[model samples]
Target chain A: MSFEPITGRYLTVSVEGAPRRIYVEEAGQGRPVLCLHTAGADTRQWRHLMNDAAVTASNRLIAFDMPWHGKSLPPEGFETQEYLLTTEAYIDTVLAVIDGMGLDKPVLAGCSMGGRIALQLAALHPEKFSGFIAIEASDFQPAWYDIDWFHRPDAHGGEMGAALVSANISPFAPEVERWNTLWMFMQSGPGVFRGDLSFYTKDDSLIARLGQIDTAQTPVHVIVGAYDLTCTPEDAERTARAIPGATLAVMDELGHFPMSEHPEGFRPFFLDALAKMPVATAQAA
Target chain B: MIETFTHIQSQLDASPHLLRLGRLFSETVLIEVDGDEYYLTFDKGRIVQVMQGPSRKTPWRFALRTDAAALSEFWQPRPAPGFHDVFGFVKIGRGRIDGDILCLVKNLRFFKEVLGLARSKQEQAA
Candidate 1:
């Protein structure tokens, strides 16, 4: 229901080796914001927010389909690999995008896996990202850090219960909802979830590693919907703890994809973040 | 097709409150008696842009862009903040209204007509 009056044509890029298809909307171009979608969500996830006055007024919103998820082709057998690898591969792809698009460093904004990827990319190549606005990024570990872990709906649960699990997925459409869920699950597969969970849930902790990194000192803004089912308020608090001084904006009556769910609320918040970022970063296209 | 005006002429014609506009450079008038600077532009007698605010660079005023294609086929009803069933015509790019306040309120009818074009366009598309 929340959509911006903006649409973009599709694009293909050579990230992590092969060609990947992406979509971008350039409106009232100024500085650029490279947007990454959550796991299971393509660039379409940011469709409404891209149209947000904050993004369109003074910035170009660049959204891309994660490999194997949208129009992009997951490398041969790579689809069978773990997600951490996908994240690694995706970073390379994102780097290629910056160079390919001939864009100077941009602020990286993403949600969920997209959020985690943003953080990882910033950690690895902080110079490329001028800032971060990660929303409901997955717990470095799904089991340990995740206060509420995703699971197969209890078999003992009734069809009504099963319907709840199914509905949490794609809200649109009826038939093939199961396939939709399976397809969604396959893209982020259990393997990747387990692998990332190891690093995220490791006794060692990724925050320590992230804290140690002396990358580009870009501003970080952390956001989570007040009603986020995936990343609870606690998770958001912890995220702020890890990224000291991170601006945390919580939207009411919004879910995991708050920006998409409640643009009226999220738009202003995101703009405020942009308004606060270094003027030069936001000033340049 | 409407005739296009250079600067001030365009501002005078598109504006519903022209008398209050006085001069482009002399006075920065709002829509009503105390509104923002509202301007209307026409090319070949056809209106191209209707704006309320200071200028076009970063239109703080809500500048609704429209062409003939938009005017003829007003978009069908959908849902929005101000409209009941009208989606209004889209004039490409984002709409900004900030400088003058009254300019927006005074130009609602003219804006609605242009938006009507968008509303029709949706009907054809759907």
Candidate 2:
């Protein structure tokens, strides 16, 4: 019988004084790499990375679905309250996961909203991480589309969400992978995508706090896709410039969801970015 | 313009699955290239009529406006980054969408796919 090398488990983590059963997945073994998914998405976005033998060869890749995402259910009494992911709450959840998993200085890698939080993590607690791979991230990204479209009753939230995101995937990406990425957005729970956007688009810009990120302690590598209009290469460039010694790479023939839209194409850029990180570089040495 | 839209209609009709995906979509949409206007009416997934207009009487739920040059570039087999998608066009200031955004977003996939038929036609012609 054929089987994949990945393993999945559930961990109880506290977010805002409430217990949340977070779904976590891991593969391979070595230097830990904590993967964070984009807004409205889950750990499934990292499936390709986790399954790849090359990436997993010397890295223990770990990914988890945020509360109210994927297999992770929201805390009890979720129906009564409107879900909103504030910066404080998001950071708390990540900290809980890192502590619960007992990861010592793991390389933090995230995409889009996940990437935005990576910057926050760097500024707030650079000592906790060895490096950061911020993909499709920027300090201040203005909301490009109406958030209401993702949840209004007049529209099919799933399809509308998927449709909006689908445009951001490169036309060159494999048809199957492109569809798979859209499928994830399509599966998002009602208001979940909207709630996530509350932080992504409406939250305070990191421009003011970016100077606090000490790259000497923890390296920051920003990667942006040329075709990602939402967080353009210019945005990433501006972000890199703000943080002293931070590096930026603009990947061609790619879009917003680089890793999910075309993993094979994204692997080289990802490896190159990872190689620049102190922890990964030391491991290679 | 009529011929081009006619070709789009035929191309859209050829794809059964695309029509099925739009089974719930039925609306009239306006398409403006440069200054010329065209009204496209859809009934449950099929484009039944394509009417060119300068007439103000034609009511449409939504409208997508762009220059002829921009629309042509958008129809290319592989357009540039900002010209790749409708939203991309809007984001980059190459296109403008107006009227009831709810109607446009509710049937977003269907509308996008329908408009994308022009690209397929362009590809075939090339």
Candidate 3:
């Protein structure tokens, strides 16, 4: 029987003084690389990256589903409250996971909401991470549509969520991967997408804090898909321009969920971006 | 143009996935290309009628309006970034959607696929 090289485990991390059981997956051996999924998504987005032998050869890739997402399961008594992710809450969780897993300044990589938080993490705790990869990320994204529509009783949350994100994928993407990306969103729990978007679309912009990022100590790499209208190439460009020594790559024929939408096409760009960060080698030493 | 609408209707009918996606979607959608109007009526996932209109009486649950050139661009097999999807069209100021947004969002995949059928028609014609 054939099997994947990846392994899954659970890590109990304390965030906000509450013990949360987080589902973590890992593959490969070398310099640790922590992968963060997009908003309303889980660690599955990193399946392609984790399974790629090229990436795994020199990296021990780690992916975890955030609390109330994927296999992580909401904290006890979650039914009574509306889920809203704040920057502080998100940061605390990442910090907890890193410390809990005992990663030695792993290279941090995230997409969309994950991407935004990477920037936040860089600004707040540059010393904790060796390098950063931000995909389809921006310091600030204006409200595109009413977030309420995502969880309305009249609308089918899963279908509507999938449809909303479907436009963000490039038409040139592989058919199976494209639908797979949408399938993840379709499986999202009701109101969970909106909850994540609360932090995503929050008016608090990270523009001012960007100056705090020291790319010399922690290399910052921003890669964006040309077809992502939601977080356009312009947004990524602006982000790259804000950080001194930050590198930017604009991938053609890709969209918001590059890693999942077409991993084969995304691999070269991701590898190239990872190559630019010598911090990985430095951390390994 | 009427022939094009008819072709889109036929193509949508032929798609079982689209039909399944729109199983409960029943509504009339207005497509206005540079002020020229075409009404598409969908019932239980099937495009039952296609009508060209400048008439005042035809009511639609939603309307998608764009210029002829923009619509043509959107119909390209691999459309440029902003012209690729209905929301992308709105984002880039190439298209406008008005009326019952809930109705449109509810069966968004269905309507999006319906509009996208024109791309295959264009491909075949080419």
Candidate 4:
């Protein structure tokens, strides 16, 4: 089936006790399915998913640009700031968006940093989401590598964004999709990418807390790309096994940013995972 | 032409990105550009030593060898085709990545950003 292009609007939400504008995009209608993007990326990552006729036919698909990302400007008085995305700030922003938009028991689906946050959302506020779909997420990701250079201010004019261009895409991905993925990287801010990794590799810890997540109350599904070196399939397997009744799927020929890097190739797996997620249990108070 | 050890060291010293990227990397990396070799030592996140010639006492985690031309192309403000990334060069056999594949993959972004600093220096020189 065919559908209209996804459209977006500015959302003014309270961040850090001050009102800040966020960009939220939407398509279709029914039970809301909130899509979150990877670190340093914007809502554009969900364009294909939002456009999928089957996805939007019965679900109101929505995505948003986090504060200081995409069309959403940095918070007030922080224009000149070198953004550092902390776990507290990231989770707070997501909660604010949900409350401000009045989304009732929406399903949460995210990849990478977003995937990590989806786990956090489900764990901390299980009553708020019906189910959680996490792609390329892991618990207790050790800081095995470094990215100090990417956040360096003096490194300006450097091709810091280019660093992510070819790093994660599967070598076998289609040429058009591969270049499109690179385009997204080239558009991200310099320090923002590094700042996002600060949390992805460091702060967002779920190992000790995974036990708190009850899959019976809020169903959870994990998807890992077979070619993802950063959040390997092994990592997702361990995470899935930790959470009771959490299902895991390993997608072949896909890498870190599966949602965007290979949307068409990724759609079937995403649909299958969605079909297996439990229905909404309850609504937020 | 790309600057030598001293200049690159100073660049790393000035970049917060480099400092963070090097934090967990406490190894000596041997970089060979067109057969000219350079050794970089990291402590914490600081580049402790950068010297010409080969490393003596320490075993390097990786030795990434590529010609001067490929390096130059990769550092262009907007590199086309084979110049966009190291993997691109590897695809065409213009670059060779040897040593720990795991280490290379994990820290790929850091290394790429480190190399990308060349564009800033080159632009400043222009």
lDDT of 3 by residue, A38-136 (tens): 987899998998999999999899999999889998988898989999999999999999999999898899999999999999999988899999999
Of candidates 4 and 2, the better by TM-score: 2
lDDT of 1 by residue, B26-48 (tens): 22222211224456443433444
State the DockQ, from 0 to 1, for candidate 3.
Answer: 0.84
Best by DockQ: 3
Backbone collisions counted per model: 42, 0, 0, 13
Model 3 lDDT on a 0 to 1 scale: 0.90
**In candidate 4, what are the lDDT values of residues A1-285, reduced to their tens digit?**
954678889989997788889999999887788889987788888888888989888788899998777898887777677678877888888889999999988899998889898998888888888899999999857653455655554453124444544655664467687767766666777677777878888874777778899888888999987666668788899999989889998887787788788898799988987787654332433
Q: Model 4, stretches more than 4 Å misplaced?
A: A1-3, A154-158, A279-285, B1-62, B65-126
Binned by DockQ into CAPRI classes (incorrect, acceptable, medium, high), candidate 3 is high
Chain B: TM-scores of all predictions? 0.34, 0.94, 0.94, 0.86
True-vs-predicted CA distance for residue B81, candidate 4, Å: 22
Q: How far off is residue A109 in model 4, in Å?
A: 0.3
- Put down candidate 2 lDDT per residue, B14-96, tens digits, no spaces: 98987998787788899998889999988888999999988699889999998878778878887788888888889889899
Kept native contacts, fraction for each prediction:
0.00, 0.79, 0.79, 0.09
After superposing all C-alphas onto the true structure, candidate 1 shows an RMSD in angstroms of: 21.1
lDDT of 2 by residue, A178-271 (tens): 9899888889998999999888999865879999999988899999998898899989999999999999999888999988999998999988
Ranking by DockQ: 3, 2, 4, 1
TM-score of 1: 0.53
The DockQ figures for the candidates are 0.01, 0.81, 0.84, 0.08
- lDDT per residue as tens, model 3, B1-126: 788789888888789999998999888899998899999999999989999998699899999998888878889998889888899989999889999988898888889888888998788889
Off by over 4 Å in 2: A280-285
**Winner by lDDT between candidate 3 and candidate 2:** 3
Task: List lDDT for all candidates, in order.
Answer: 0.51, 0.88, 0.90, 0.77
Among all candidates shown, the one with the greatest lDDT: 3
lDDT of 2 at B37: 94
Per-residue lDDT tens digits for candidate 1, residues A6-123, read 6666667776666766655544476778887665445655666666675677777787665554555555677455444355566777787777677777878887667777777766
